[model samples]
Target: MDELEFMRGRVYGADHDDAAPRPGRVYAELVGGPLDGLLLDVTDRTERELRGGVVLPTEIGRHGPGGGAVYAPRGPGDRRFDWRGDVP
Candidate 1:
């Protein structure tokens, strides 16, 4: 199957630079732009592990730096991604 099939239409505009969170580092920080210094998801996956964020194509608002995609949580309130290695 194609790589897209594996994503299941969750991520978009991905150019391959995107990567899973490093081990022990659960919080995702904004590298640059207006949202710089911002801490995003708390996924506790290592670089060699799977992506912990479960975002859909429709959920992604735009493409981030280095081909990484940015997505807003579907639920209400502040966006808080699971940091304990829990997948959606």
Candidate 2:
């Protein structure tokens, strides 16, 4: 399924217990940057965070543009994916 599809039709419970970074953010950063993925608006978060997290656009699954709020703080500023290039 696409990112949008995965995110659609339901609300993901914010899980703060997991210290791992948001997977959606990683995918966004990769797809929306030098990684060859479509670029996304930094303001567009990924999803609901349990403790303190980010949210990205839900439509990001298909790799189109904007679809819905996603809550993503790990995009570029979070410093999750480097080596490729400075995110922000």
Best by TM-score: 1
Q: Give the Cα lDDT of each candidate.
A: 0.35, 0.34
Off by over 4 Å in 1: 1-25, 49-88
TM-score of 2: 0.19
Superposition-based RMSD of candidate 2 using all C-alpha atoms, in angstroms: 13.7
> Which residue pairs clash within candidate 1?
23-46, 42-83
Question: Tens-digit lDDT track for model 1 on 1-88?
Answer: 7543344322123343564334464454433332333345444444333233333222222443323333333233333332221112
Q: Which window of 10 residues has the lowest lDDT sum in candidate 2?
A: 79-88
Count clashing residue pairs per candidate.
Answer: 2, 27
Reference-based lDDT, residue 12, model 2: 33
Q: How close is every model to the real structure, measured as TM-score?
A: 0.23, 0.19
